[model samples]
Target: MRFLSPDFNFWIWLQHLDTPDNNLNIPFEFTEANMRQVKEILSHYPSNYKQSAVIALLDLAQQQHGGWLPVAAMNKIAQILGVPNIRVYEVATFYSMFNRQKVGKYHFLVCGTTPCMLRGARDIEQALLEHLKVKRNEVTKDALFSVGEMECMGCCVNAPMIAVADYTKGAEGFTYNYYEDLTPKRVVEIVEMLRRGETPPVGPQDSSRIRSGPSGGNTTLLSDPKPPPFRDLASC
Candidate 1:
């Protein structure tokens, strides 16, 4: 979201004041089944508060559009929710979770927060960029992969983790694999496996690391202790 030029940044901020653009001529629709789902979502709220379901409805639209929210999708959501098109646009732009632009089949959201960074998140990021031959937020030429940094994935114990979202597979079979406790070399191998259409073992990349436990073996509480015999209250 950072711009090098101050003037361009100001201009970009001005776009927020303008109405959401629906210039794209593409048609967007909610199918009968999805419409039923939308209705069910709306039913949870009162008639006056139906607009509360805007977020969920937009999510459905994004899923239907294959993981990216196109301008046309926002238009459809605005119409369905009986709100101004700019309202939906505001929510979409405010949220980092929503992908306004296109993403590759596998969107790698690598955690680069404090824990991950301290444990070598930069190495993992560099490896991914080199392997994909593209910079952050840029998709590969084949549109198979894209990489981006996230604040945290709540996997601090398994620092340097990434969530691989598979959009190539349809929503029904969509899968997100979290590859954790990564190294630069291991990440490269994982991406190569993905490129070959092979599933890589998820979770900790190290064979010795168990979940978030210490590498190799458990050091603390290494021995099992016998339970103390119960004392009878009558004896006291």
Candidate 2:
């Protein structure tokens, strides 16, 4: 709840949108097998309240769409679930994870959060812009890349992390690639590899031992557990 800050008037706004005569009855352009898979996703829930399956359905649709969710695909979801199309749109827009516009072969998402910024994510972002000739919210001319600045992506240890969502690399090799301890040079190299239709392994493609360990590395994980639940409560 703390992270979900969506406007509450979405339903009201939907009713007012001038719908195309065929809008309400539109169907998803999915394959018969995919449709079956979607229905099965719903079978896990109890009964008619299909809205409960919206998340999984949308996610499946997104994967079907190669990481981005299309408006019509969203509409299809609404129709299949018997919910308002606007409702699906509402869900799509509220989640940053869903991409509305078509993303590049690789969605170059740079984290601009505190730790990343401190670690040089800005440098990496600037490098991406300069090297790829694109800016935040803009896709490359070649359509091979798109730049996006997002919040903490849980790579604080490897601050300056970027999640590559190369739509070209369909469902297998890597769903997501996190680049950590990035530099302008490193970022450029990664993009160049991507532009050439290659997935240059996940982290710093260079020879640096940045994430390796605190021999000054990029990988840092907490060593000690904070203690089981209230195990230390008595000490308080």
Candidate 3:
């Protein structure tokens, strides 16, 4: 349930380098528009409590710049919140939702917890890796997909479930789709749909399944229960 162990400190030293990492590796910074959002987030707290908005600001920064938290973004947030840069780093690293490195357009996060593992999460993950031709946390050559592991997503009944995160530009901001009750074959099909730039159906992949309810059909609740006779009020 882990990806490549990211350096977690790459950004701290980038500022001291004589030359830029590369043309595409530009320093991270919040845009003027994003700064306005940061101000709004900070406004939720008192002037003396700007640090309270650190988590919210970091999320905004990540959304504004693809799906990862760059060092420069954290530094900018630290300055605005009037806290040490390390504080921002702590929050970023503590949360798995915040990616330190860039992710592909679609991040296929499979649950690798006990319940999921018992249900075939490993096979699902292997299918994804093979279909995408990338190891865990590695982006595909085309940058279309990246595979990773996640803890239980509270969908244990759905045992093997995947949370597909889409960072591609669209009318709406980011969109997350969950496909539950999946098999290895179905998982690959889902990836193929994304590769074709098509939206796959979200939720349970099986038509017979309903949410996390009994698969196939409702066997226990087949008959409606009759109301019980009410006791006389005087008996009380």
Candidate 4:
């Protein structure tokens, strides 16, 4: 549920650092203005307790740099928040939703949680490892896909979910995005497309077989229309 931490003063320092201006250690996409905006978002909370903004700030950095967080970016976030760099790393590492290493342009994290497992997530994981021709915790040759198994994604009703596309490009092509409600074939197709640098639609896949409710049918009941009656207010 959580994503990033926030910082203010340190971010400014990071911007003014001797190193050439950069974004996520990639090229510069997030400008100083962007960091200021992130700071504004963090300012809503006390500066000492600014870690609350970690999730949001991570998201902000990811968005700024095309979707992944580099060590530099994390350090900047740490400095801005006035917290130790390790604190930011701890948060980034603690959440399954955050990415420490490089990932594919469309990172696919298969959920192996109980609810997801009950719905056949193992096949999903195998499918990714096999389809992408990459092992768990390894990046593909194209640098466009890293498939790993993850914990619950909090969508039990959907079951068998995947977290995809947390990032766009870094050491890995993309990192930190999550996708849910999928089948092995569906995930494979999406990854293949991403390998070609294409975007795939997200959310509950367009499959009639998925069904709805117990019977896989609509539940709205129909009723007959009644005749309208006109009421006339006469003398009191």
Candidate 5:
């Protein structure tokens, strides 16, 4: 269930320095258009509380920087928000959603909490890693895919689920889609679809089911219920 260990901070720091795809040495600033968006985001908060937009700005920065936030990008966000650099770093590190290092163009986050685990989440993870020929958090040689583990994504009814973040189309075309109720074979087929630049349908993989409804069709509420009883308050 735990994706990060106690030494995660140290590991992430090392990655910042050593990861070739993430050039931490380079400077990062918001684009002119992104800056305009930043201004719009800041507008939602009072001028005195611009710092409250830290998380939102960090997300924008990540999107602009190709799906991960480098040290430079975090620093730039701190500067823009007028807060200490550590504040931005804290937010980024605390949230699993923020990737400190580089990820593949298609990053798969498999839910591994109790519900998902009991439903074959581990198998899904293994299938993805094996088929992609990459370990958890490691990008494939083609830079098209990577796999990671996540806690419950609130789709327990669907159980075994994955959330895919597609960065192939850049920030403007970025998409985060969820695929739920999967078997090992089905999940791998979804990956192959991505490899072929095809978008597999999102949500439950089982054709017989819809959304999180019962797999064998509704067992209850098959017919409309009688109208609610009404009291004559005026007469009383």
Candidate 6:
């Protein structure tokens, strides 16, 4: 994920990693249930192509590890998949979705594509950063929130949206919720709701919208159209 800072250099930052406490010290292994899941994931691939399951396994590992992939977790995934450690590390680091370091309980990924940008995504992002008192990708002192940027999330119709990944409940309760049709103020309200342990309704936040519909209401197809004429073979 790209940070908000203009001077941010991902490559340079990659060289000097600031990881979570005991990230490498603690051993990581899938739970009994997750181990069963690993078998299921492997089932989809041919025996010799177990490496193909690297991405899926890494995602599972992230979920199991509470939203980030620790070094030990990546190592464990490599062992499970029987691939080189670099295989898993490469996949994990390449994907923006996989977090290398620890994130907060709630990680907000704001879409900054053309649609969202034209609809004031930057303002929404700034509002979140300001309210949380943290820079993009920086976790709050309380470890409750962090902000990051993402590409189009396919919710452009409801532009200026933020996808909040809630790790508060851990793997089972983990939820990736999208809040669409946002304003700076509305986004903050959603954050406040989350902070208070309240589950704000997901999807289009605007009162007038019903999940990306026209702002006020449907303006077209107000009346039924005439039925099409059917040609009979007998007449021909």
Q: Which candidate should be chosen as best, given lDDT against the real structure?
A: 5
Cα shift from native, residue 126, model 2 (Å)? 1.3
Model 2 Cα lDDT, one tens digit per residue, 1-236: 22122333223222333334224354447677778888788788766888888888887777777766656788888888888988887787777777765567688888878888888877888888788776565567877788776789987776678988766755343377888777788788888887776768886544545444432553545476566665666787
TM-score of model 2 (CA atoms)? 0.73
- For each candidate, what TM-score against the reference? 0.78, 0.73, 0.80, 0.64, 0.82, 0.80
Per-residue lDDT of model 4, residues 1-236, tens digit only: 11111343224322333333333555323577776788698879987788888877876776666545667878878877888888887887677566555556566777877877877787888888898787675567876677655677777667778877545544244444445567788878877777676767665664553543322554564466576986665843
Per-residue alpha-carbon lDDT of candidate 6 for residues 8-77, written as tens digits (9 for 90 to 100): 4334225425444535678998999999999999999999999999988888888888788878888898
- Among these predicted structures, which one has the highest TM-score? 5
Candidates 5 and 6 compared by lDDT, better number: 5
Please report, in order, the local distance difference test score of every candidate based on alpha carbons. Answer: 0.78, 0.70, 0.78, 0.66, 0.84, 0.83
- Give residue 199's lDDT in candidate 2 (0 to 100): 63
Q: For model 4, what is the alpha-carbon lDDT of residue 61?
A: 76
* Number of clashes recorded per candidate: 0, 8, 0, 28, 0, 0
Q: Alpha-carbon error at 215 in model 3, in Å? A: 3.3
Evaluated against the true structure, the overall lDDT of model 3 is 0.78
Better structure of 2 and 4 per TM-score: 2
Question: After superposing candidate 4, which stretches have Cα over 4 Å from the reference?
Answer: 1-30, 169-181, 195-201, 209-211, 214-236
* lDDT for predicted candidate 1 compared with the true structure: 0.78
Q: Report residue 42 deviation for candidate 3 (angstroms).
A: 1.4
Least well predicted 10-residue stretch by lDDT in candidate 5: 1-10
